[model samples]
Target chain A: MPEIILIDDPADPRVAAYRDVRERDLVGREGLFVAEGEVVLNVLARSTLCEPASLMIARKRVAGLADLIARLPEDVPVYSASQEAMDAVVGFHIHRGILALGRRRAPASAADMLAGLGEGALVLALSGIANHDNMGGLFRNAAAFGVDAVLLDTDCCDPLYRKAIRVSVGAVLVTPFATAQGDLLEVLTAAGFETVALSPGGATRLVDLKRPSKAAVLLGAEGPGLAASVLARATTVAIPMATGFDSLNVATTGGIVLHHLAFAALRD
Target chain B: MPEIILIDDPADPRVAAYRDVRERDLVGREGLFVAEGEVVLNVLARSTLCEPASLMIARKRVAGLADLIARLPEDVPVYSASQEAMDAVVGFHIHRGILALGRRRAPASAADMLAGLGEGALVLALSGIANHDNMGGLFRNAAAFGVDAVLLDTDCCDPLYRKAIRVSVGAVLVTPFATAQGDLLEVLTAAGFETVALSPGGATRLVDLKRPSKAAVLLGAEGPGLAASVLARATTVAIPMATGFDSLNVATTGGIVLHHLAFAALRD
Candidate 1:
């Protein structure tokens, strides 16, 4: 069981990492991120890829989370404070009453992550998805559909951003992902994966796509869709849409395409 | 052509409807709602169901929106203001540089809206969807899949909320919708529509669902899925998901189910 430390003061030196969470935005730079709420904290505790550095909880919530606390390694510190003190530390009312600080394992190259997957793999590759909300939603969908791994270009936003993690409901913690610079399509193609790009103007309709033994679906940000060069290099697929309507949200689009690909692979 | 009226004062009575928009939440109660941005303004101007009460544009954007202005009816007042005045009127930076006040027509009953759809209709029925962002995303997906109409239970949030309208990219203006305080499934059933409820425990998988000549998919809010009574009354459908994962977002769920239904109907 982990050690339980009682904290009465918000200014306690040990809780400095939890101060002004919204203003800090401390996720990617130092391999550290925060998992908020009971559900997310549970997932973080059980996640194999992420390790909890420490935990903080409201005094009232400790009894409810005893089983979870007992599961943590002895080296991990667990701190409990009054609701008022916890709020003062976080600079906000955290009604969820539980939070865990996590550290990501060493980074993996996109190629190394993909090479470990078994045959008949389905992956989601994204470029220019700078919006944190969309990034979170995409990770959530990726987990739901069982994508083998997610590949992100350097231009994409960090999936571990606090809002992104919250929006994903902790999916970001479990889904294996890698980010790198350069041509994402060329890398996938060299890995013997069928590359498909989603665009408004494309040669093939999304529903008509046949399942491939190895596949990667490329998605771009909304407004300015997939770069023209990316579309030119990959097999372009379009969702049949009503005339005069704008494209669907990027995350929603990813969900639809990924759902189709997932089920199609099952049939094959 | 709309008559252009220049106003230097932010407190002018003509633009009172667009004041303190965030605090006022004025949409359906007084038959007035505000539309922002160039694209949404254009959609509101052309909508046959929603009529514009007046339009306010930044003085700099007036020349750029000349063609859109020409399309507006002469009776609709077109007010132009300096950027500073426009920001002061809306209580924030009106970066989009455009705003239009719209008045909703007499609401059609759920039955009336369903009755007006053509044969082989596809409809979306939402219950207890109180979040404005989800409501907006649902409409955007509905338009992308060419849904015939949308029916909302009385518990659902107003789709015309300013945030929802903006998030939907103005799909709310073009899609026919109605809200009533009763069993939405019964209304759809009475209108000769097949009803399907999406739930994790659904008896049939979504991919296996056959297209019906007239169908409506029932979706409830995220956490407490569809009410038991509603699920019992309609055909329950599930998306095949990986083990140990939670359900997809309600709006993303709608996109996948609707995409399948739309294509299946075409094949039929």
Candidate 2:
């Protein structure tokens, strides 16, 4: 069982890393990330892609989470503090009372991840998705649709951002993803992926597009959609929508396209 | 052309409806709703279902939006204020510089809204969806997929709430919706509709389900998905997700289901 340490003061050096979470998130956490709430904490405990560094819980929550705490590795420390102290340490009022510090494993290179996929793998590639909520939503949808991996262009926001992780309901913890080192499209092409870029003005309707054995679906931010150069190389597909309406939210677009690809793959 | 009136005081009576927007949204706005940003204001301008009650814009924005303001009905009042004064009036920093108070045409009864649908109509029914962002997202997806009308059970939040309208990117203004007065499912059934409820343990996979002539897809809040009683009465359909994963976000689920129904209808 992991050791339960009682912490009475917010300034305890042992819990120093948990200080001012919101501000720290705006800066960087070195190589670590904070996971909040019971749901995400549970995901961190069970996640193979990331490891929980430590846990801090409200003293009142200790009894309720005893079973979960007992399951933690012996090396992991569990700190119990008064809700007031917990709030002070975190620099915010987090009612959920459960927070975990997590460290992600070294990520594989984008090329390596793509090359390692099975012949029938489906991948989601994101470009310039600046909104953390959109980033999280894309990962949540990608995981739901069983995409083998996610590749992010350099301009995309970090999936492990506190808000993104929370918004994704812990999907960013479990989903395998890598940041692209070079041109994302070129890398995909070299790895044998039949790339499809989703845009409003596309040549093929999503309903009529044929699925490839190995495919990557690309999505960009809401306003400036996929780059023209990227669209030039990939099969451009559109999800038919009411005329004159702007494109669906990028994450919603991801869900629709991923579902179509996943369902098509399942049916055949 | 609409007249532009400048106000230097934050407490001006003419703009009282725009005061403390975040708090006002909670207290209810009588018969009015606030739409923010240029995008939604533009939608409100063109919307046939909702009329612009007034416009409050930052003084700096007046020049750039002159053409748009000129297109508005001369009867609608346009109020302009300095950015500082506008921020004071709204109780927050609304950098968007555009705000429109809109009055919805008295909504149609759920029965009448459903009864008026085309023979080949697709409707989205929502229950217990209390989150404003999800509510907005569902409406946005409904609009994107050409859903004829949205039926919201009593438990659902108002899609016209300021935040919901913002997250929906103005889709809420253009979509037709009704609040269900009686048992939602019973009303749906009475409208010559075949209802489908989405859940993790659904009886049919979304891929294999045959489309009906006029269908209503029901989605519930994330934790307590469609009431078991409703699920029992409707054809329960599941979007096949990865094993052991929880259900997708309610709005994401709406996008997938609506896309499927809309696309299937288009093909046949």
Candidate 3:
């Protein structure tokens, strides 16, 4: 069983990872990635591939969760803070009383991500989506729709940011993503992938495309949309949209596209 | 033409309407709302109903835009803050460079919302969605689909909250919405509206709805979903789906439904 120690002090160094998250934003390289709430924390604890380093809970709610709490290594820090201290340490009032902190693992390289695709995997290639919540929602949509991976072409926000993780409702950690694509189309195409760009003004509707051996979707930033150069490379596939909706958020658009492709491909 | 004045001090009361927005969550009673970026600000200034109460611009970037800067009223507060003081006032980073404080107007009531419902009005009824971003996006999607109004059920988050306003890209101000619903079914039935409860396990597909004269979608909170009593009171609509997908965010799901309804209602 993981050791669950009582913590009365907000300043306790033993719970250091759980404190000072906002202050860490000023540090060049020390921002904390926190997952809070029972639903999210439980998901993090179960993601053995990227285990949380420590767990903290409200003192009163720890009784019946003994079995779930035992899954972590005993040496892994587990602190039971009063709800007040839990709120104080987290920078804002997070109602999700339980929080788990994890050291971010190095993200997979874009090249390595392309190499990992199975025969007909679908990947989301984002361009200029700066909002963390939108990125998280995209990942949540991707995971729910069964995309193999998500790749960020330069200028997307960090997927591991606290707000992104929260907006994703814990989907970010479960959905595999990689950043840094040098000439994104070149990279995916070199990896034997055909690129499909989702746009309202495109030449073809989404249903027209049969499954490809491997597919990558190029999505642009929210307003000005995909760069002309970026769209030039991908096959233009528009979602059969309702009139006047010349836009969809990068993530939701990615979701609809992924859903259609997943169904067309007959993938689980 | 609007007047522009530069103020070096953070203490200047002229910019007060736009100050401390992230921290001051309640500005609704004051009848002022903030819109960031040139795009949303421009849109607000152009709209007859919305008016900019103040304008803030970066010192260096103020040179080229004589026309946009000139469009404001002379007495309207236009305080050009140094980038440093600008950051201090807004309570977060100001990457957008320009910000506008606009006058808020009373929303059209649910009855008034129905009175304006032409053949193509798509409305969103908030059940328990309390997240600010979700609330904003729901409103934004409503506007994108030309939704007539969003009716806030009791207990939904305020659309005017800074986070919701910011996240919706200021679509909250553009969309017509009001808060209050005695009974979800009763309101829709009285207004000649079809109330569709959007749930993952719902049996009716959106495409099968046959495009009613006027329709309103009932959406729920993120985690717990629609309360059973509320769902029990709805028409129970579903989006077309593939097998493994769980559900889209309440707003996105609403967006998909609105899009299809609009597509069917209007040929363009």
Candidate of highest lDDT: 2
Candidate 3's docking class is: incorrect
Assess the local accuracy of residue A57 in candidate 3 as a C-alpha lDDT between 0 and 100.
84
- Which digits, one per residue and each the tens of the lDDT, describe model 3 over residues A155-231? 88887787787777677777678776577788888888888887767787765667677888788877778777877
- Positional deviation of residue B39's Cα in model 2 after best superposition, in angstroms: 0.7
lDDT of 2 at A223: 95
Off by over 4 Å in 1: A26-29, A265-268, B26-29, B265-268
Chain A TM per prediction: 0.96, 0.97, 0.91
CAPRI classification of candidate 1: high
Candidates ranked by DockQ: 1, 2, 3
DockQ pick, better of 1 and 2: 1
**Chain A vs. native, model 3, TM-score:** 0.91
Q: In model 2, how many backbone clashes occur? A: 0
Q: How far is candidate 3 from the true structure (C-alpha RMSD, Å)?
A: 4.3
